[model samples]
Target: MNRIDGGFGWVIVCSAFMTLMLVDGVLFTLGILYIEFLDEFKEGKGKTAWITSLIPGTMLTVGLGFGGIFLSTLVCVGHHFEKRRSFAMGISLSGSGVGIFVFAPVVRILIEEYGWRGTLLIEAGFILNIIVCGAFFRPMQKQSGRTTEKSETKEEAIDLLRCDDNLIYIKENCIPSDKNCTIEENASQDDDVHASKQEIITQTKSTKNTTLSFFSRHFDFGLLTNPIFTIFVVSNCCTCLGFNAPYVYLPDRAEEKGMNKLDSAFLLSVIGISNTFGRILFGWIADRKGVNRLLLYGTSLVICGTVNVMNPLNDSKIYLMIYASVYGMFIGVFVSLNAVILVDLLGLERLNKALGLLMMFQGIATFIGPPLCGKSYVYNLY
Candidate 1:
């Protein structure tokens, strides 16, 4: 199919949405699970924090590093869309927000009824749905055919060059000549042909070597050399240092401020709903002309960071609800636009490599952020 705007692309979007819903949606429920871990394990706050941190850390680091289903789905979606790519990405990523909205209360009820371990087991079963989603990702037929045609053309050209008739024809037609051509001139033309042939062989060898070297690396580290990409990674690391702390701790924070566990869980749902709207809205805005995606992303991050910094000061349930709603919306904007902005910066060709590297850096931040926040809670409590 030659379609780039829709059709199978929408199918890929749905699959991506479902995959992210299962993967990231469950990941965000760590907030609800965090309280359960504290009660059950009774370990140090820092020690227990690892449970929530490592799951996402491993998902981003190891999963993305080795072409995790999430990244693969994204790549599939990218392949299927061009002009509407940002909108598609936004719609797909919005699943995470929707998942958070739906799962927060579900996880809460599960925890109250079945406890954390049973809840986890049930979630594990839900996660298997990703495999079903993976089935929808059919490669584009034209792209595959083009690749085969190119390879076949290369082989045909090689075979033709080796034919005696083709070589004689090339010698007669390609080489500049006169009926009274001197031996010295002929010798010089032959020398030029030999040098050109050597150059082609050397270029082919170098191309093969470069391809092999690229595949040898576990993840592409060359992305780090891109100044724009490097800046993006560093900024992401800084943002993530505090980004997930709110998700993992918001429930506990609500509970500590005198809300019941059920009510506390509802806070995540509030965030999730607003987050869903934010993602769709921002995505639409991103596709319009004259709108800068990076500026939108930065503005959202600033708003989220400010709200999180002020979270401890608010004790009123009404205020907490309002804060959660606002925070959720802005965070959703950042999440939805994150990949889209990268595509804007680097284009689609390097997106997978850039995303993998971005995930690796964010994973490092994920691992560290929660533990530090957990320790902060410990210190503040004592």
Candidate 2:
């Protein structure tokens, strides 16, 4: 940690942010292309739906698994500094929201002027931003502090001098008040020795209970053992189950109500605009007004939005627009609440592991949510 406070870390952050934004933008906008391919390829029912659905499957399932396994290592980067941790996380987190802000209009305009194929090409370019971002993501280089041979020798002498008076005693035996203490003194007097013994015992027990692999810590089921943690996980899973479907299907719904394709595309941009506002305003309210209560209010808004969406007031364009705007606000709240709620539940120390696992499970929902909802819509229509 002492060796890493320098220029290269920030460079890595910027590069990683750019690349992640591109990949994430592609994932978010896949829904828009689902309908396009459905029409263009003349696919029927479930087959046509796979285009958008398939993409996120790779992201959610594969990406999440890898993230969970490596999260312990990945989260270590933030441990070196106290002040920069939140700022670093917030900076990274804000990328997805920023991606939404940047790409929403671009998608709208491209789909408006050219078509879906053009939009995919544009999304591909956005994905390439990963490369740009990756360039800056260099591993932290060790910056050793300056030390001459004389200073090194002096430090060693000082350490020896400090140790001379700090004699350690066993339960029944007295040790010398100098560096000449024996293994018997270590066994009796040293807390570090006791700690090491305990650690060895723990590893032995763990090995007895589980298989013997070098990377024996292959999984962490300790997270799911907590009841409150389990409940939040389930709630988030259900939330994702219904949440993304509406956004993905909204354009189609608008068009079904006799809106033009261009207008339908524009509606998504409007939602993004409203979502940006929703995160900022509601995030502030959550902090000031109580995060839990504010979250309940947001969840209530989601329920209301869902019910509003089910309305047959399709002919009333103003009512439809109003619903869309409100839905955007509700979803924005939902998205922001995701991390905040996890932090509230788990606290900062375990947040990365909790989030990694939470999102891995949520990824299952993300992968399955839209398609299941889409399929249900078809089945209900029949």
Candidate 3:
């Protein structure tokens, strides 16, 4: 079959980019959703909060960890064109950046105009776009060069084998014909060689298949059996555990501290803005300074940010803003670093599975972290 360059390939790339952008934009819009959810569902806070929480919590819990399945699928889907793979991924990732830029202002406007209920519907509409774009994602197919060559060679050999009667000797060498050869006799001999080559190829492939396949194989208890991997998994989970709580609670906390609505909203924006910068900065750092150092630095920052929660000087608005900024910076850096560090330790081949496993743990944290923190703050308020 002829290769399809002009048909589905470009469409698939466009779809992947839009899908990621839409998915991530909704993910980032969680802060807006959480506020609306809290006010709307104050009587059933715990249960309803889960509705707002499920996506990121699932995404972080499932998306980050198991998200490699999609990542690998993307690689396999786009693998045929060597030149386009990086371009495709770059385009896809750019969705997050674009989503953030678009979502910030759009969300601000929607909240101003329609309030939370309308904002929720708009965000839902954005996420639904992923489904529309995803429909266009068909895998690229390359022409089967090996199968074509093998078929042609087999046909030529068969034709030559049938060229003579004393063909046994001729089949052994596949010499076209001699005076001593007959077509029928030589044909059987040629079959033996053809079968032998096919058998060798099959045997080689079977032997090589002994190694584990797919990213998930690494998670098959070997890493779990190791003390170090277990420690890393647990520590990373703890780090992620308390990580997003502050972001969810920052606006509410600002209001509690006697900051006006505009300032509280600005505080939320500061976190979002800082978070975008943190992801970029730490992504670069993780690639260069080693993921381990970035992890340590990021975790320490989270600890510091958490400690700032009990700041004795809660009366200082300027100080509080700085603290929130630093906290956002640290958490954002840590979140990005978590992926790189896990991938680095696990190595690229096994990274996705390992992260998927890690996210299962983080998902639990996502479910528990915010409410627990929020309730505690509420208790103190009373």
Candidate 4:
């Protein structure tokens, strides 16, 4: 059901926006949680960080942000608009920035008042709204057109592309047999109906099996056969190694450098606010003629890396704020066009599978990145 720059499409954009806000809000404020965990558990930073790493898939608390709402939102936007996809993606994903802005200070205060465990419970409440947004992710609608089958012998021919109880919708609208037009003299419509029903059941079971395998084991290995895809995947893997470390450690680092917890958490808000503007600005720029999305993405990533590397030059709050703003803007550009750049490289047909595979790699990098950052921070501390 593609409306393609239509009215309801904006509704979907809004849903995506809110979804990201909740998902990333919980995920990005881990720094607030990090301080609490250390104070409560009396654990070393490296070991404590493995706790943060466990939240995504293992813990019920951080699990809200973990279920790939981030990827799913992008895929949902992909289904609706084409020409303005970059712009739509920007708006939807900018919710991450919004989440960071709203959640960081809130989480810090909650931890200070409620304890980390209490804070986790309330944060869980914040994340559950993602389910409400999930309602707006309308499924693809069938194309409308009338077709007469070559089968005067058949009552109905159904191309059952997919049939599942969870998503109960149907294409191939049934047309009743006309009063004057009958099948052959002896033919029974009842037999055809029964056959069609059996076929549908068979396809439904097959679809279930195929979908399970597709999510788990099946992928178009052919996509990896392309040299360009291989290079792209490897390059992204490299880029992601340093990407997530800062978020997990930034607030804690600020606190260590003698800033109060509130001020440290506010740094994430600065990053988030800057990130929001960056997503919008870069997304709009990508829409203009002659703009190279790949080049823009690469440049932004390079700049972000530079900022991350240079962040430790001073303990000054103003300098840290400047660093946060610069890093957040480029981070926005990277995310805004991430899938857009992929579409240019791989086209829409392959996006769903391609993105899943891409995220699998990036997720590995994300999980490894922060803990390794913790190890470095631990080393530097001693």
Q: Which candidate should be chosen as best, given TM-score against the real structure?
A: 4
Q: Return the candidate ranking by TM-score, descending.
A: 4, 1, 2, 3
lDDT of 4 by residue, 3-95 (tens): 786667888999999998988888878877888888889988878887776654232222234546776788888878788989999999999
Give candidate 3 regions above 4 Å deviation: 1-22, 44-48, 60-105, 129-147, 150-219, 258-262, 289-312, 315-317
In order of appearance, the predictions have TM-scores of: 0.80, 0.66, 0.63, 0.81
| Cα lDDT tens digits for candidate 2, 145-259 | 5446446545545443333233422321232233233355434444333234346567888877766442235434588999988987887787767666655776677778888
lDDT of all the models against the reference?
Answer: 0.80, 0.57, 0.57, 0.78
| Candidate 1, residue 353: how far the Cα is off, in Å | 1.0
| C-alpha lDDT of candidate 3 relative to the true structure | 0.57
- TM for candidate 2 is 0.66
Q: How far is candidate 4 from the true structure (C-alpha RMSD, Å)?
A: 7.2
Q: For model 1, how does the per-residue alpha-carbon lDDT over 176-225 read when each residue is reduced to its tens digit?
A: 34222234555445533333555657787897779666664546787788
Better of 1 and 4 by lDDT: 1
For every model shown, the clashing-pair count is 0, 4, 10, 2
Candidate 4 clashing pairs?
1-140, 1-141
Better of 1 and 3 by lDDT: 1
Off by over 4 Å in 2: 1-24, 64-98, 108-118, 134-219, 289-312
